[model samples]
Structure formats: structure tokens, C-alpha cells
Target: MNILIFGYGNPGRGDDALGPELVAAIQAENIPGIECQDDMQLQVEHVTDLTGRDAILFIDADASCVAPFHFSEISAEKDDSYTSHAMTPHALLHAFHTVYGKDAPPAFLMRIRGYQFELGEALSSDASENLEAASLFIRNLCKSPYAESWRSLHRG
Candidate 1:
């Protein structure tokens, strides 16, 4: 299955870099059937990139997530202002649905716990540990033939 992964966060900040760090690890492997992309944040145009993928994965650092990493399914939800600078996973899904007249691919969001996001800071040791754990989890998923099992198991 074709899997599209968008990992977005400010790498300049401390733990906020977890998203892009995970993407870097995944991309370094050069796995097939998986396309990994990174950005400072999600944008309107990114919805279009979701087209034709069997599934999509959105990765970000979440200060509030209790687990090392939490996975949740993404459902389309329209935003009042489409012109906003940044968009959430659900809002992006809504945009894709509106543009294509159909639900976007089965999408999941992986939020890795983050403690800090200070400017010009390197990752904290704790966040680095979490990043390692999250990276291994995602790498295993990418190695799988299909992401359907993960979707079914972690639907939210």
C-alpha cells in the first residue's frame, strides 16, 4: 500500500523537533512504498498531497499527550477559516474531502510527547528517548505491507 507520512514541527526548538527527527530516521532507511515528507507546519496545499495514497500518517509533537506517543485516526472536520496559516490533520482531511468530493485516505495522527519548545534549543534527553521509541514504532509500521491493521487497531 502507498503510505504518505507528513512530519511537521520546528526543529529549531527543543522537543518540538521530535516530529522532524522521526521523519529523518524513517527517511534515512529509504524504505519502499512509503513517502516521507516534513514541514515546519501543516498547510492547505498539503491536503492535495494526500490524494491516491492508501493511507496517510501525520506526526507531530504534543505536549499534552500522556504516552510516549499516541496514535489516533483522523476524521474530516471543516475549519471556519480556510485561509489560516496552519491546519490540523482533521482540517486538512476536510479540505481534501471538499476538493475531491470524497473522504481522504484512512489517516492517522501520531503525537509524540514533548516537554519543551524553546527557540534555538537542542532536544532534551527525555525527548530524545521518546523520539527513539516513537521512531522504532513508526519504522515497524512502514515495514509492514499495509497500514490497515494499525488503522483498525488504533481508530479513534
Candidate 2:
């Protein structure tokens, strides 16, 4: 199945690098039928990247999420972020539907637990471990790119 793995975050900020870091790792695997993209943050323009994909997965670091990580399917919904420079995954999906006149491909989110988001700081040891766990889980997900397979593995 075709899939897009989109990760967004500021790499210079400590744990905020989780998203881009994970995207880089997955890109290195060179899996077929998977397209990977990373950016400092999500934006309305990102909706263009959602076209012609069977499924999409968004990854980011979340300070408030449970340790290690949290995963769940996300639906499209217009929100406050829609008017801002930085948009949420849901906002991006909403934009996709608005622009394309059709619902976006099934989407899921993985929020890797993070701490220490200070500028210029390296990833914390705990966050590094969490990244490892998330990486392993993503490798498995890539093995079965179907939405049904992903939903069954949801943690949220």
C-alpha cells in the first residue's frame, strides 16, 4: 500500500527533534511504497503532500503524552491552528478535504513522549530511549502498511 510518513518539529530544540529524527530513520530504511517528509512544522501547504496516498502517519514529540509514546487514528477537523502559521495534523487534513473536495486518506498520529525542549540542547536520555521504542514500533507498522493493521496497533 502507498503511504506517507510526515514528521514535523524543530531539530534545534531538544526533544522537539523527535519528529524529524524519526522521519530520517524511516527514510534510511528505503521501504517501497512509502514516502517520507519532514518539516519544522505542519502548514496548510502540506495538504498538497497528502494527495494520492493510501494512508498517512504523522509523528511528533508530545510533553503531555504518556511515556514512550501514544498512537491513534486522527480525523479531519477545522481548528484554531487553521489560521496560524503552524497547523495541527487535524487542520492539515481538514485543509486537504477543503482543497481536494474529498476526504484525506486515513491518517494516524504517533506522539513520542518527550522532555527538555530547550534551545540548542541535545535529546534527553529518556527521550532517546523513547525514540528507540517508537522506532521499533514504526518498523513493524511499515511491515503492514494497511490502515486496518495500524488501527489494531493503536495505543491511544
Candidate 3:
């Protein structure tokens, strides 16, 4: 399947760099049928990126998720972040639907567990371990990029 793996976070902040770090690793693999992107944050303009992909995986660092990571399928919905400059994955899906006049392709969010999101700090040792675990999980998921297969791996 044609897949887009979009990872977003502020690399300048500790642990928040997980998303971008993971994206960099995946990009280096040169996996076929997979396109990877990294950004400081998600924006409404990103709706364009959703077009023509069979599936999308949005990755971010989450302060509240369980250790290692959390994963789940997401649907279009207008939430409070819809009005902000930085949009959430759900808000981005909503925009995709509103702009394209159809439901977005199967989309999922993988929130890697993080701590110490302070500016100018490097990734914490604990968060680094979590990132390693999440990295393995994503690599396996990419091998079978089907919606149902992805859903079966969901954890929170």
C-alpha cells in the first residue's frame, strides 16, 4: 500500500524530539511504497499531504501516554485544535474531509511516551529507551501496512 508516515514535534525540546527522530530513522531505511515526513508541528496545510495515500500514520510525542507508546486509528473530527495554527491529527483529518469532500484514507496516530519537554534539552535517557521500543514496533508495522493489521496492534 502507498503509505505516508508523518512525524511532528519540536526537536529543540527534550523527548519532544521523538517524532522527528523516528522519522529520520525510517527515512534512512529507504523502504519501498513508504514516504516519510517530519515537521515541527502539524498544520492545516498538511491536509494536502493526505491525498493519494492508502494509509497514513501520524506520530508524535505524548506526555501522558503509557511508557513506550500508544497507537490507534483516528477519524475526522473537529476539535478545539481545529482553530489553532498547530492542528492535531484528528483536526487534520477533519480538514482533509472538508477540503476533499470525502473521508480521509485510513489514518492512525502513534504517540510515543515522553517526558521533560523543556527547551534546549537533549532527549532524556528514559525517553530514549522508549523511543527504541517504539522504533521496533513501527518497523514491524510498516512491513504490513494494512488498516486492519495496524488496528490489531493498537495499544494505549
Candidate 4:
């Protein structure tokens, strides 16, 4: 797998549902070979998925961060204490790095802005809206270089 876009969140919570919801939206795009998962707790065993991938985009909801968006490659040596979510991508990266040494593929992190993580029946208005944006972003990342251009199709 060249790209693994992992999204994690609690579906019952308002804005926290962004991760799982984004997965569903991106699925309809039908980007071949792009693997998507909606997970609550990340495990070290999942690191095996990074073997031959060129890039990985990991996303989740942020509960305590000021900004709504950030795109960056996570550092191998960085501790995940600063992460806004309860689960940490850094830990996964670290485990992969340790197990595979330099062979592990590079991983990038993306996050959606969410103010409300409260238990609810549906997503909040703002969060529901951002789910569309987040899904579009994932689609752009998954489209292969040799595939037909579809990024232009997504507007706003």
C-alpha cells in the first residue's frame, strides 16, 4: 500500500465524529489502493501497514488545540504529549520506526478543527460542515499520479 489514510474519532460525540465521517465520504470517491480505517484506539500492531507505503496521512479530531488545521510530517523523536487527541500518532510512528528501522515509510499528520466533543445524536452544524472539507482533502491526497485528474472537481 502506498498510502494509508487513517482517521480516528468517537462517532457519538458531536465534532469528534469527524474522523469516522470523513472516512465514509472519501470512500465514495473510489480512489484505488487507498486504504481507510475508522479507529478509536490505535495499536502498535497497526504499524505493519506502513511497510512499503510512500506516504501516510493520519487524521483525528482535536479537543484542546487552538487551530483547526495543521499539515506536517511527524518527527520520529518527538513525544506526543502535545497532541490534541487522546490517541497519539507519534507513538505509532515511533513504534514503526523502531521495528522497521529506516525502512518504515514517512507519515504525515492532518487534523480537523472541532470544538464540541460532547455526546450527541448528530454532528454539530460547524462540525458537519467541516466533514465535507476534510473528506475532500483526503481524496486529493489519495488520487494517484497516473490517474485522471479529479482534484479540480472538488470546490470549496
Q: What is the C-alpha lDDT of each candidate?
A: 0.85, 0.95, 0.93, 0.66
- Candidate 2, residues 30-108: lDDT per residue as tens digits? 9999999999999998999999999999999999999899999999999999999999999999999999999999999
In angstroms, the error of model 2 at 30 is: 0.3
Which segments of candidate 4 are over 4 A away from where they belong?
64-68, 78-87, 144-156
Q: Judging by TM-score, tell me the better candidate of 1 and 3.
A: 3
Clashing pairs in 3: none
Residue-level lDDT of model 3, residues 41-98, one tens digit each, is: 9999899999999999999999999998998999998998978879999999999999
Q: Which candidate is the best by lDDT?
A: 2
Query: Tens-digit lDDT track for model 4 on 100-155?
Result: 77745666666777878878757777766666666665666665521123223322
Cα error, residue 52 of model 3, in Å, equals 0.5
TM per prediction: 0.93, 0.98, 0.98, 0.77
Better of 1 and 2 by lDDT: 2
Error of 2 at 38 (Å): 0.2
Can you tell me which runs of candidate 1 are displaced by over 4 Å? none
Q: Which stretches of candidate 2 lie over 4 Å from their true place?
A: none
lDDT of 2: 0.95
